[model samples]
Target: MTDPVRVVLVDDHVLFRTGLEVVLGADPRVEVVGQAADGVAAVEVARAARPDIVILDLRLPGCSGLECCRRIRDELPDTQVLVLTASDAEDDLVAALRAGAGGYLVKDGDPAELVEAVLGLREGRSIVPPDLAARALTDLARFDRQAAAGPIGQLTPREREVLALVALGLRNREIAARLFIAENTAKNHVQRVLTKLGMSSRAEAAAFAVRAGLLSPS
Candidate 1:
């Protein structure tokens, strides 16, 4: 049998944290390994627990949640972060992604989504609330279109090609088939594109591509 996924909860609210523990605990596939009431203890508990995922809140005390997220990711490269907060602002989402969070969800969603988010992160999928997605993309594209000028120049010709295909919503396999390259090579190219662009995920990179006219605007 597969081992249960270990998770750490980092939120300041006692009632909320306990409620989350209960919800996640009901799923046999997940195990709640630790809890932190603030940003400072967040890092310390996460390091000690060494969980597979850390569900953090953006509004934190003792230190900002962004700093905690960044520190934890820097200190533990293997552990993924999932931001669970009440804020649905695009800036918070962008900042969280920059700090290495793998998923972002607002507090008002169904509890089942939280479970799904945990599973999705474990399976290497990026998660964001469905409602905020379109707005986030268009706004991100507008903002990044300007910022991408300097960073976009950093990408090689081949990497630029890869970014365009990625913007077209092609998966690594499809990109490989289209370019007559190995799937792993396509994946590597995608990663290099994101890294050079200083973007955290394919979503952000794709938005940049759309604004730059690399992909036809839909």
Candidate 2:
């Protein structure tokens, strides 16, 4: 049998966190391995637990959820994060995605969908609410053409290929499989692509690719 997806729940509300714990724990497909009430504890718990997914809130204490997401992702590339919060602002969504969060969901969604999100992130999929997704892309599309073109030109043919895939929302493992290269090689290519492009997150790269005509919006 396959192993249950390990998850760490992070939120400032004790009642909400406990409720999510009960909701997720009832499903055998997931195992809630740890819980944290603030950003600092969130990172520490994630480092110690090394769960398949870190589900957190945006308005966290000590540090913003975006910072925690970045730190955890930087330190543990294999561990994905899902932002579970009440905020549905386009700015927040874009920021979380730029921080390398694998998924973002508003608090009003069904509890079952939250479970599905955890499982999906475990399987290497990016998740965002349908209603807000288009708006986020539009927000990202506002960069000046000169800014986009200069960095786009700096990429090698291979790095460009990697960039295009990242624009298509392919994770490193998926990109490695598609390009017939080692996962670490794909990771390096992605990092180089990001650095050469002067981008912080894959969302920026994806938006740039679309603006550059390397990828079409879905």
lDDT of 1 by residue, 45-86 (tens): 999999999999999999988899888988987798999999
RMSD of 2: 2.9
Candidate 1 Cα outliers beyond 4 Å, as residue runs = 144-146, 156-187, 200-218
Cα RMSD for predicted model 1: 3.1
Off by over 4 Å in 2: 170-204
lDDT for each residue of candidate 2 in 1-218, tens digit (9 for 90 to 100): 88999999999999999999999999999999999999999999999999989999999999999999999989987788899999999889888887888788999999999998888777655677767777776776786767768778889999999999987778889999999999999989998997887665565577668778787677
RMSD of each: 3.1, 2.9
lDDT, candidate 1, equals: 0.84
TM-score of each: 0.81, 0.82
TM-score of 2: 0.82
Q: Pick the lDDT winner.
A: 2
